[model samples]
Target: MTTRKIVVSALVSALAGGTQLAQATDVFRLEGFGAISRGMGGTAVAHDVGPAGMMTNPATLSLMPDGDQAMIGLDLVTTDIKVTNKATGESVSSDTHSNNRGPYVAPEAAFTKRIGAWSLGVGAFAQGGLGTEYGNGSFLSRATGGLATGLDNSSRLLVLNIPFAASFQVNDKLTVGGSVDAMWQGLNLDLLLGADQVVSLIGANRATGSLVGVLAGIPGLSGAHFSLTKDKFLASGVDAWGYGGKLGMLYKATQDTTLGASYTLKSQMNDMEGGATLTAVTAGGQIPLTGKIKIQDFQMPSHLDLGISHRLTPQWTVAADVSRVFWKDVMKDIKVAFVADAGGDLNILLPQDYKDQTILSLGAAYALNDSLTLRGGLRFASQALRSSTLFAVIPATPRKHLSAGFTYAFSKQAKLDFAYSHAFKETMDNTSLPNTSAPIEVTHAQNNATLNFRYSF
Candidate 1:
């Protein structure tokens, strides 16, 4: 009945029960949204793809054929990850080969209506996320002085987005559009901090930031380490709501060429609140405490995209997009605070130090006949994460991608599209960190497919 009720209902129906583990290209953001865009190398801005435009460049919704349209899409993502923690001088080596939990599915839907010069649309989609799962036998279970807790190591994050968008055809050659976005995000993490990292956080938060006084008060506390683990009973995990907006412009520079640009603002979200099991280890013994955790100041970055679509011939079309993500602004650090029920509080800051990302996508489509079309594309991206700060739990580092797909029309009002993409494998050795003897090496690659069915009445 009311706006607050509407958002709450939407989140419950859309995100309450689902656990998504989708991979990303420009960090935690997907390379593309819809099947058509994925089939053509994540190109969408100027290409009249489909209602998924509500999540990309809403101005393109005006380019859809007249009348009402509805579409549903699904993406299946599979990721391969291998992590190796080796300390040559210390003779400690461990490797987790393909321990990621994946081959996950993401769903999307949209409806759009065109009335005269105005186009209105609404859509929901899985923006993107990252995850990994390592068993209890993994090296991550061991603490300082060879103490083993036998707890698994894992991390999962998912973001779902809803957009209400509108576009206006200002003139024969110009169109503009905007969308207000509602976003829901879920995060689950179980990380084991090494003795050195624990010491670093303690020093950084010494002035009452973390449980400094309590830690300092612990007698016989030497060689300290710890972990913040999610309770086994909490399935959905810590979550929060976020909001942002996007503005887009489309211009028909020529009969055969169209240009498009869009800007998305940074997201504003509250802290993620949830329960966690905090385990603190010391030379004396292991202290297990129950507490509430607040993940603070976690927000998505802003970005700008510019693209062009050109009809080279009656049977062929091509599109190219260049974009930049301002990660340096939002991904500086991740801060978390824990208040224990027993008698203490702890604060931790995880450094990200992500650089701005540059992405280039190029794609081409050709109509083979009246009912069939073929597409292929390539995407290139500059590395966004530095090896020194890259954590094994979140390895979003692929830099190149190749994709192909096809579309088939069953009738004037119905069609099916399918696309598949592969991210090239990459390996990073964390030799840049101070402890080069125990460099963490990660190898990651991905494959994903998108299927969409659309109908118009």
Candidate 2:
């Protein structure tokens, strides 16, 4: 293989591995593209850039310098996630903080070449990922009388995407660009079986299903006999691949204003291999359960974006963007196909009635001197999913973000960029399917920093 191809492959691999250690943020998307865009609230569609523009809007590739340009960026992210279950009969309520994830860094890299009025680029970046782990003792059994008090629950997910793109300068007035991305995703979930569901499946009096075994002496059962329908830790994980693409256009409306628009199609991935396994411990013994997600239509959502950039003065530039994501179809429910079951299929209707969400971004940059530029911006979005569907593993519910950054050009060919962003604390309330006295509450917050090095030929 060529040296360029080798470097590209290595970089993509690195991004995939790094996200395994970071927590979920901004729902499932990063707030911005790179140091430059992050500093200015991730509004890069109408701005000028080289490799960073590949993920934001391929059309911006045409806005780059005439020569070749390359960039590498690193993002350091830290998260605070907490889940609180309300107190109920025989079971004591709990407030647990999930801190197992974070202090992680994700990377992005790209190379762009400009020839005549056309530009070609290839890049890799970590889209988003989340991880959560709750202590075993955090949950108590009011029914089991505390015998099953130890709970092992957690989840992790990551997406690493690679895009090949090209842009054309149709005229001084417009530029168009397009790209197709190969999307790869990994998912891991370790969750406790629902108390109510367990009751329905195994309770001695419920004659609906045949009982293979029962937790005979467990006091938490509240004087009822029950069997294990699911495992204590359901570790269902899979790595899968999919495809998607984007189309964009940049318009020079006037000497001072630039307008941009783009649309991205959804990505569809195959079923997760090795499915998931469930382990149940009982007086009768431990029974193993297994299943795979019925990925009839597992895919990432599609979105549309519109942006504007205006030059107010020789030293000041301002930009704003509005984006909408359609999540209703892809996120409403999850189905699991067990190896064999009398109930036919195990289908869990998720509370994730994720609606079509709208996000707004605004930012400005000032050229302070020959070598320094200062930037700051804000990003805002409403709720993506309803409180009833909120879960501890994926807390993508923050509503506001603040950021600031600067760039230092050491020479004509080299530059260093930095930006820091913070998503304020937000709380989400959820309803558990069975046995909840009150809504379960989840709180989330985040801090992110970006650094990048770029060179121009």
Candidate 3:
């Protein structure tokens, strides 16, 4: 084999091994931002100040009055992503991954009442959800030696948050509130890899082709063919649910200034079971290999947010928030059983010691006039999932952001909000692989934008 062929084969082997490590553990860090302008700007409006606020900061519900208020909104999002290899000249490029996903309704309803010096509120809302897909045959099938291989992977997640909160008015200048949340989450993954034709080539090369050519004809092995064929398939699916809580305090330090702080506790899910089917075909008929995976425990990281909002004037306000995700607590490696019908069982594992991340955000909103409001913000977010843990199925980008948005009140009870954000470019270089001294580098660039509308009564 030539040096180029050797390098390409080595790279492919490294990628396969790296992906295997990533599959043992599942890491999800997608946060659902609200469809409303204010909600999207600052930790989603403390979870109660607006119709959608209950999605994140439930205690903010105390800011509402006794009347029933309902809000329904839609979000339109577009994303652009590119992946390339700098080492080899082979490149795969496309804009097909860029598409609009939602207008999927985000709705919220709340009831609030004041008793003595305290306020009580109850609310239900769709906190946030994620859905993304990118697939094409050409991108997956490119291979070396004029050979082609196909692979595809996709995933989806749905999450719901229900919160109950109470606020106590301490004198006339301060208020404190806390909320307990009941969270429901579900996730699904689908992956397809390896092809029968590709396996046939491997088998042929190892068996007949390696010994049947001119060199073989000159030896005593003439006209003799020795080959081994390999065919394998893998499929898996899982479902789980869990609960968590949030504690928050709001201090009206002065008539025009307010300070807020909150901490959300980590939640763990236990009752999850899934099945994986693997089939390996050789010169003989396909043999079925199946096994069950029991998820012992999985936890989402805890987060803390500190925010300050100041009303400079009756028509102008500014807000800023800094938050940290405690990824350190997520330190358990995932363990699973890889069983073959006759081969017994082997252990597949993935490490979960991810690094902690911080996010800093700042925004300002100005009432252009009575019915119109203009808003803008800047945000910086640290990467949560390490490249060693990332696979083709979940392509998330690390980012910095610039955003602008507007809200127009159509009437006393209805309003419309719109926002656009651009995430600055960043790259990830992963070198961790098993049994290999070299690393395969995969680089990605991302851009996303969103628009939404909100109404209240």
| Most accurate candidate by lDDT | 1
Mind giving the per-residue lDDT tens digits that candidate 3 earns over 205-292?
4212221232223322101110111111111145456777777777777877777777878876554456655333222233345665
lDDT of each: 0.77, 0.68, 0.48
TM-score of 3: 0.70
Ranking by TM-score: 1, 2, 3
TM-scores across all candidates?
0.90, 0.83, 0.70
lDDT of 2 at 45: 83
- Please write out the lDDT profile of model 1 over residues 1-457, one tens digit for every residue: 9643443344345433454557776689888988899989898889888888878899999999998777777789888887776663321121232233566678777778899999998878888887677655655556655666566566777778888999999999999999999987777777776565565655655224446666556654433333343433223357889898899999999999999999988989788888777766666676777778888988888999999999999999999999898999989877878888876787767777999999999999999998999999999999999888887778889989999999899987778889999999988867542122246788888899999877765
Best by TM-score: 1
Collision count for each candidate, in order: 0, 12, 7
Worst 10-residue lDDT window, candidate 3: 18-27
Q: Residue 357 of candidate 2: its Cα lDDT?
A: 82
Candidate 3: misplaced stretches above 4 Å? 1-32, 36-40, 44-49, 91-149, 191-236, 279-288, 331-346, 434-457
Query: Which residue pairs show collisions in model 3?
Result: 47-53, 47-54, 47-57, 48-60, 48-61, 207-226, 207-227
User: How far in Å is the alpha carbon of 49 misplaced in model 2?
Assistant: 4.2
